[model samples]
Target: MTAVRIEREIERKYDAAADFALPDLTGLPGALGEPEVQRLDATYFDTTDLRLAARGITLRRRTGGTDAGWHLKFPVGRGVKEEIRLPLGRAAKTVPKELAGLVRAYTRGRALRPIARIETTRTLRRLLDAQGNPLAEIADDAVTGQALDRTEPVAWHELEVELTAGEPGLLDLLDERVRAAGASPAGSGSKLLRLLDHR
Candidate 1:
């Protein structure tokens, strides 16, 4: 019953990477300005043995500001992931079946559960084009994460700039400005993976 697209034609890969950096476009209207750092607590889920990982997929239930819900982020391309959101529910410890079934191609009927918990303190800025269209979003994040098997905390800071629907060249233009702002690129390709790694 889910209207989600199958997209079987999409190719899958095991090892892919990209450089991520904070976007700098504070001068434009609708740009996100220095966001007060906020602590974000989230839990990531996957099949008992990571069936989703084998297929390059990620499913997580997160609670935070305006966007709290079940988020399923599918790998689309380098530096890009398509995020699907569902309404937040009462079940904080389990992945919603509605969202999980969408990953059947990857999970193959395997069970999914909590694999990690991630905590992030995010500082955000918004970038916009001259026409007031959102060109990109830049975020500076301080992350601390706890994996299921480990007790020690992992900490790091990263810059992330997500592009809006526009010319691809805009990313390059933004990247130039971001690098000039003294921010270096981070390793992961997707925000979901970065959060999951820490969780």
Candidate 2:
């Protein structure tokens, strides 16, 4: 059995155009490093009625990238979430019992199944302090998602800034820069919810 690790995630999302460019942040408290690109494919699971999504919770099994595994996220508040992660192991197309049990309160014995598939081409840049310590990660994602009930896929571009070892002002500063770069705040809570057209 793999041990589950939980952490608090503080991040913000924004909607961008296909040709959007990142704003310059090298002159902030830290410098922005060269971008690292990764391709990420994730399949979200939920009951047919989307019980988990209704409550602002998400479960997905993802491959590729540095953190490929099963992830369960619960909304803690605006721009904050409690995330639980488990190793990929050998599981495929089947939700791990450990993760499923964690969301049983919402599932109420309902069967869980794949509801959406989202693929992302991510360009990641690290904001680093003078000592080379990471302050935050800026992810520019080009995403395509297919909902179980939809015949065609939806595509969009978004920016995500996740805090690492930075103060709250770091997020506020980035937000100003991102908005000035022509990216608006994301309309949906997540890719899955947006794809599934939950709200």
Q: lDDT per residue, candidate 2, 48-118, as tens digits?
A: 99999999899999999999999999999999999999988786789999999999999999999998999
**Which 10 successive residues of model 2 have the least lDDT summed?**
190-199
The ten-residue window of minimal lDDT in model 1 covers: 8-17
Candidate 1 residue pairs in clash (backbone atoms < 3 Å): 31-126, 32-126, 116-199, 117-199
Instruction: Put down candidate 1 lDDT per residue, 57-96, tens digits, no spaces.
Output: 7677777755677778777766666777776777888777
Q: Each model's C-alpha lDDT?
A: 0.62, 0.91
Candidate 2 to truth, TM: 0.97
What lDDT score is found at residue 43 in candidate 1?
84
**Predicted structure 1: lDDT:** 0.62
Which number leads on TM-score? Answer: 2
